[model samples]
Target chain A: MSKISRRKFLAGSVAGGAAVMMTPAKKALAAGSFEGFPDGMGVLVDFTRCVGCRTCEAACNKEQNLPAPAKPFDDYSVFDEIHHGQPRRPTSKAYTVVNRYETKEEGPVFRKIQCNHCNEPACLTSCFVNAYTKTPEGAVIYNSKVCVGCRNCMIACPFHIPGYTYESVINPVIKKCIFCYDTRLKEGRPPACVESCPQQVMTFGKRAELMNIAHERMRKNPEKYVDHIYGEKEVGGTGWFYISGVPFEELGFDTHLPKEPIINNVKDFLAVVPMVLAIWPALFTGFHLLATKGKSHGHGDDHSHGEEGH
Target chain B: MKKLATYGIKPHDAEVKADGQKWSLMEKLLLGLTLDQYLDQLKRNKFNWLLALIFAIGIPVIIYRFIFGLGVVTHASYDYPWGLFLGFGLFCMVPLSASGFMLGTTVEIFGRHDFEPIERLALLNGLLGYFFAVVYLLVDLGQPWRLIYPMFVSWGPAAVLFLVGWHVATYLSVQVMEVSTAFFEWIGFPRGYEFIRKGTVGLTVSGIILSTLHQGALGALFTYAPGKVHPLWYSSSFQWIHYFTSSIPAGLCMVISVSTIVILTMKWRCDDRFINNLDRITLSLAKGAAMGLITYLFIKLLAVAHDNEWAYIATGWGAWWLFEMLAGVLLPMFLLAVGIHNKNVLLCRIGAFVTVFGILLNRLNTALITFNWQLYQEIPHMWEIVISITIFAIYVATYRFILNRLPILYQYKAQAVEEGVAVEAEQKAAVNA
Candidate 1:
């Protein structure tokens, strides 16, 4: 019992490290507003250029080595599929899907459903095992080896990007788009989805350059594109943003999302945590002193007598 | 067990027998009954049949979940990632189990010894509730084997779940220690019992810290999904407080509910000390619960007001929320108030039961029902429901098994019996003189 086991020693060090890293005050003070890495890459998507060709989805499936879809990617009938009163979303089997939303002005707007790879990702922040990481190249990648399968990342993702392979009994894990980090982004090449677009709907470049390009395009044709660029300032900005000709809300975007990071919403509670941890013991121990002062010390004495207490 | 009482037999509640013989571990586990007698009693209890029925249907499905995967047994929807397994099991079970720290604070820290009769029961309730919550988690976790990843393999200290995992694990240990006094007494481990008693204050205080953090942390987990949870059910700043405060009433009421069931079904097992004090302790517990309810209610409304979500009150979800508040919170609060004022135990019991239901409703509403309100509603698959019921039944059985043997509902009479023998020996010596 006196021996400190290896696991315990490692646990203590990890806990110590976590405590140092997780101090909410330190974080709040250290980081004011982190938009994105200066040189990090991103994609600019123009909804006007997208023709709902579904080529990007096919490219993604092939690149990620995902299982064959129930319907072939070329089938336009897949656009009509809806589940739970919503349009088709990316699933474990498919990392990216194109959902078609009909607009009053524009007959149909194809929205690519994939990981936004936020500058500050909610999934990355919400993960307890540090399973998700935001690489310098602006890819939100997941390490499945350490994933406990709590699925908190799924709950935290505002974009609803990650999917769980629930069918796998032995090694179910989160299956989501990694922005082709391993094969493309690491090599400084555009992702398959972006490169495979025949209409060149997506322009891959540095995040700053893309933001400027999106604004320039919006400025060049103010009448054609919506004034707002989706994901530019939404949920702390994202690696992939859209300049939709139609309103983002009409195109199935949650426009009402807070501009600040999702973790900001949690900071208030986290700030209180250390306070509770620091103050509760002394306050409660003082309470014990104030409560039991000059009274029966051990509970065993008065308990048998059935004394009334408040 | 009640049938056994009719035969002039008593369940084990002492270390030594009336004939001065010590009980074997197996005899102690069987409540001092012969194997045949224990088997007969078990066969006679109708509740065992129901438990058998649940285990029959649910255990196989649980094994099937392990073999085939969670996709087969659950909705397995990515949008509704946590269904009944966590919604009912982890979120709901944790708050109700707050009784351990609540009662520990009351009897140990606050010097309220009068509540001691029910303290062990609350501790046991807390321990088993958490134990089974973990069981549910293990079943729900994608890789239950790697649960320790957060502790040793990797760390996301800033995440709300990290705090939850740490605090729950630490507090579970604290509760096991708190509840172990009864076990040590039952098992005749005086040193262990004494050791635990000496550290009661430290254990109780640590329990408060862990309970306060993790209980709040559970709510904070939802704050990570600010857009997903319905605004009526979600308050960023007040979310943790709502969870932590509501847990007090939930915990108190759960203890009250469990004790009520114990008093009704296992009256013979309860010693005179427990039986006599049960009503007063129940009322006392109800008073705490009522106070907790009012605080919880006030904070819940305050959160809505703070968030300026009055317009949501007119919607259907709002109506459902109103129903939850009125039926679960306000009604139970009113009942407990009336019951406490008039010293009505039955009404208090009813209020406690309703409060437990209310906690369940609120957690399920937050974690499953109203969550992803912008998305389609998710109804848990049939097998998921069965698994939840089966796990709860196992919890009940474990609770009963402990209460039947571990001197939780009843005091250990061994010490008094030894004193009785001492007096008898003194009388014999006096006569001889």
Candidate 2:
């Protein structure tokens, strides 16, 4: 039964090897420092500008057609709800959430959490079914149909985004902010959350232009901001850049994330794969011939050879 | 079986009975015993009752998980996507099953026939461990039906899991072929056994290839979560190597542990050849385990030094890491060394058990316990724990079932293999007369 399968595998491996050899290592290395696709749109979130009102969250739920909130969006008590010591995070039902982080002097700083939509997304690279896609329009979207629900993306996501719909028995898939990819971002419109914000806390524009605007704001009134864009160079730069009044670490961001993309960390091991596939068969076969040179072969012969030598 | 042996009734180990009558398939399946006697022995065995109790609770919970979904049974949310199912099952079981290739290399590749008596056992261990690991993976996967997506429907060849998926699928087939030789012998299928024998070298070589890549690929999967896995356990440069190297001893020690259990619990099934040569083979396997452990220790230290993580040693996690190394690695290595020096089989067995536990600890530490160190830890749900125990019980029971009937611990004699030819010759002479 397996003889045919392995025969197929042997052919498959050769083709796979050729494919690996054909793909230039330079392209892989280029991805190491890849910031984002040129002309991709991005959101610049200014943490200094927002009131604690969750209009964005309410708009996101309606735009995504998600389930109604347990408490109405106006209920601020949800901010105090902590599960597993973590403040409110995005779930399948709620695509975005606003968390209240208390600062030393500035009272409660309201931080809206959702998918950062990274340029070189860990989720995209970690997926074994090619379920995730980093669109040219700067959105990281996922296909539910092909999703095997391995959850490697959840583990790989540096920002702790992308919740699973574990309640669904038959068709559970990853649920995360897609930057309103199908509905708004594709047509060059701002997401519902961005447009719904009464405080104009977020600016939707070209990623390069947003970077310039962010730096200008920090340069002009340096004391008003923390002088750092949290997503600018984190995990190879997320499309959702953030300029905060407080330090990023204070806002519960993983500040120590590597500047290089997460896939770069895995590249070393990936490089070894082809080498082993190519080398091990001959190497061990050579050992077989050498070890059993004058002795009885492993097959069809036993005790007579057993006591003679190791 | 022990009670049956007292009556001088031998179990099935040949194709034909002593009277040259062909043994029926039913007789072979029942280990040459009547159904009543077979059922009686099973009743007398205390272990079967425990297995029965586990399966009673576990099977329903497993079915319930499918109906209610993974969330009801497991604490697998966004933070901890893999709980005990993968933490203990996939990570721990794969390494412990490494014996297939380890012994395959020793006897088949290197022609160290001295280890031949235990080679089939090692191969079977590999086959079952991997088969059950996939079982655990099936339970853990949210959409287990789409498991073939990585192979047939979709392609994400760049992902570490993609490599893992392909290698495991391929390696499992290879192990099935390797272990089928024993099955063929038990059922009196010479053509199939001979066909498998011709490809033994090819299969063993492929086994080594698949084993190396997949074992390393499992570690490589963690590289995708560099920030999640604790610094003590994470090494981008050496993580795969660490997993591969450590699996060497893990596999070797597992064989030792399994053999020890076999001797203690079901010595009636083991043939004279296996019963006598087991001590020497255990010592030989222990040497290999020792070599692997020392190499693993060196590389583990090198990984920490390579990453320049010595400073983390002073912290709480660092202390815990040190404790793992001392208790699991250093202590076990010392015990094995002392056992070998004294030629003490019992000490070696104790050391092998400790080594097995150490590998379990290492895999669990890498995949679960220390994973998401920065986040709050989540214990597996009650039903999840029950299901995990139940699946393991099934593995143990299946393992015993195969060992009890198959020619794994003992050789099926040659007379049965040549019985057909001998009968044909006699029948021709009688016709002429």
Candidate 3:
């Protein structure tokens, strides 16, 4: 190659490198528009239909092979049980629980609490070991083998669903509802809890159809239901949504959560990570050269400031 | 000839002892003291007794945490997943350890050779702080053995912790290389020292890059939970910058504080060069820290304003935030300004202490205290607190061990003075030839 061509090629390469560095790798994909897989299934819970029977809880316990609860699922007294001034949520032994919240207008309303199984799950994104996976079947499943037990997922979860087997010394792992993915959902059947709901409180179907059904129900009985579909846009939409007669906040829901996915908050930092990696080396090296120029020639007086011993 | 005592003995320029024998590596490790003198020094200190008492009670609990599980030592509440181990250890230690890169940049990158006296001490402080932070992480991790899983077994490059894990591991090596020049010189390995000296610029640049990301990334880890952390503490856009910016002051103040402790407690080990220049360096460090504090204060307020969270200031958490800012940032900034203006080394040292305390408070607030603001507060178990203190004691012991033996607080004699002259002469002769 000619000398001029070689110079042009080098210049071109440097410019190209600089251009690549200047542009962000890619703008982080925005989160709200995502509405899960086309055929992904979901459960639509109608709060007015639930009777606080705890039958779904029992079904989940049996299907997941979880240990027996402190009080039997048949005990109605368990509804009043409270610990630390808060109603009991899910534990390692229970994948789903029903909490009763009394509203002034609506009377006693029972909300079945479980993992929402978000379209873009915070637990999946925050995990360093790739332990949590959002299966195509719309279930957020976990592989305990790869879990490092950092409990970051538990912290990231907005629903506070994930629990840890912290008491197990030998092999502790995250415990959460998997939507019966292994035995039911992957086999094209509904979860055990959905199947066991005798009051027909939950309607399981394709998530898109379920959305239509929820909105239809709200439209048909505007006075009976609140004007909102909980989880439709909360934390970028969850597979399990609800239409309640009362406000979700009164039902112990964090209604103030962002409509965007949890990962949106992290994108700002993630974007800067690569820029620092690529730019800082050259930038600081240039500073070093600029700072040390002309002083490198004489290593004795210029470099050393004449401390007696040195 | 009298045998050297361990506590107050200083390394001198002389190659040979009064007995006409050269100092062996073992004797150097012993601080040129006889075995009896070293043992006597260990027994004589009351601080050692306190450390011993802590270890006696704390060590078994830490062991119990591993054998019985984290639930035994910690509250094991899933709501507050990270207790003191990470809230205090990983989050707090990483920022304080920022001294390594800060000092490295000042000396090698900025050509401020005057700050060279405490540069090695700063680097050692950084290395040990990061090293122990990882120790805390190991204790906190459920499957601590699977730590390598992030590096090799599975890759979660998109996760913020993946960045922290990678940067901290890489930076630790960079620090080892930067500080190894001292190790090589003290061990009389001229080749190793020369090789490292040639790569000083490369090492320092990489150190800056790694420290910047991981320090910021530590704060970004909380960005994953925008709802959980209080609005005052959580700003997605500014969280990383807040952490990265405050780290500058935290790093600088940590060095000043560590230097102050060294000067007060181990004056005999420091040479005239270190002792004479300490006050000036402390003042200079205070100036840098003051500037960093002002910038940090502005950005923190900027975040509050950006989030439109001024209304929260009237709440209980808002009051706590104000205390952290006033006591941790503003108070130290005022003290440092006064110290710098009046050339009061004592006041600068006090400011440094406050700044260090403030950084610790901020990290604890973000990770533990203000986390899950609506949820019930989780006070860490007594056993968890005991384990955290015990690990810190071990960190202190290791730090003292290295400072006493290595050419950190004092310069190594042979290469620093005589060989430096010889090398300069050779260079001059080559230029003239």
How do all models score by TM-score? 0.93, 0.93, 0.92
Off by over 4 Å in 3: A1-33, A297-310, B1-21, B415-433
TM-score of 1: 0.93
Better of 1 and 2 by DockQ: 2
Clashes of 3: 0
Question: Which residue pairs show collisions in model 1?
Answer: none
Clashes of each: 0, 0, 0
Best by lDDT: 1
**Tens digits of per-residue lDDT for model 3 on A7-117?**
332343343234334322322333334557788889999999999999999999999999988899989888898776678889899999998999977999999999999
The C-alpha lDDT values of all candidates are 0.86, 0.85, 0.83
Give one digit per residue, the lDDT tens place, for model 1 in B1-433.
Answer: 7765544466777778777888889999888777777887788789999999999999999999999999999988989999999999999999999999998888877878778778889999999999999999999999999999988898887688988888788778878988888888788887787666666677777788788888998999999898999999999999999999999999999999988888899998898878999999999899999999999999999999999999999999999999999999999999999999999999999999999999999999999999999988888999999999999999999988888888788767653233243544443343333
Give the Å error, residue B304, model 2: 1.2
Best-matching candidate per DockQ: 2
Q: Per-prediction interface RMSD?
A: 6.6, 5.4, 6.4
Please tell me the TM-score of chain A for candidate 1: 0.88
Give lDDT for model 2. 0.85
lDDT of 1: 0.86
Superposed by TM-score, candidate 2 places the C-alpha of residue B139 at a distance from the truth, in angstroms, of 0.6
Relative to the unseen true structure, what is the C-alpha lDDT of residue B286 in candidate 2, on a scale of 0 to 100?
91
**Which of the two candidates, 1 or 3, achieves a greater TM-score against the reference?**
1
